[model samples]
Target: SKKYHCTYCSKGFSRPSSLRIHTYSHTGERPFECPEEGCNRKFSVQSNMRRHLRVHRGGRPAR
Candidate 1:
């Protein structure tokens, strides 16, 4: 079993990609943005961007 640890937290990951994603949590960098008109929400990852889109699709305000 291959186990990788994140330097920023006590969590461990089984893949290097997972560890890389976990590092972003500590950096607070938002590289993903919404493509909707008049929408300027940004997220640290694509997954979060998708989550935000869900809210917009549900007709909820982005806050």
Candidate 2:
């Protein structure tokens, strides 16, 4: 078992992959990209890109 610690709590995982994904809260890396034409946008996580895509699809800006 692999043990991991966070600012508020700690936990253990059977596989390192789970721990690795959980560690993203500490490292701000943009790994996901927007595929829209002429829009070279990258996001720190996949969900951010998903949210951004809606804007290009005629969604109003979050003012």
Candidate 3:
């Protein structure tokens, strides 16, 4: 598989899209928003938002 490397953190990804998304960690861009009304939470990565949604579902915050 082709590997994409991040210029800022030296992390590697299999896809360019994944690397592009990972760049947000260094840039501090939160584009993903919680769909639940009035939550008002944003995340740079989609998985973070998924983890955050657990709080609204009565689950503990992700570690």
**Of the candidates shown, which would achieve the greatest lDDT relative to the real structure?**
3
What digit string (tens of lDDT, one per residue) describes model 2 on residues 1-63? 456544334656666666555556567556777888989998766767888988788775422
Question: 1-63 in candidate 3: lDDT tens per residue?
Answer: 648899998988999989989899899999999988999999998888989889888896644
Superposed model 3: Cα runs more than 4 Å off:
1-12, 60-63
**TM-score, each model?**
0.61, 0.52, 0.66
Clashes of 2: 0
User: Sort by lDDT, best first: what order?
Assistant: 3, 1, 2
CA lDDT, candidate 3, residue 36: 84
Error of 3 at 14 (Å): 2.9
Residue 12 displacement in candidate 2 (angstroms): 8.4
Question: What would the C-alpha RMSD of candidate 3 be, to one decimal place?
Answer: 4.1
- Model 2, global lDDT: 0.67
Model 1, span 1-63: residue lDDT tens: 549988878689899988777788998877788978889988777777887886668955444
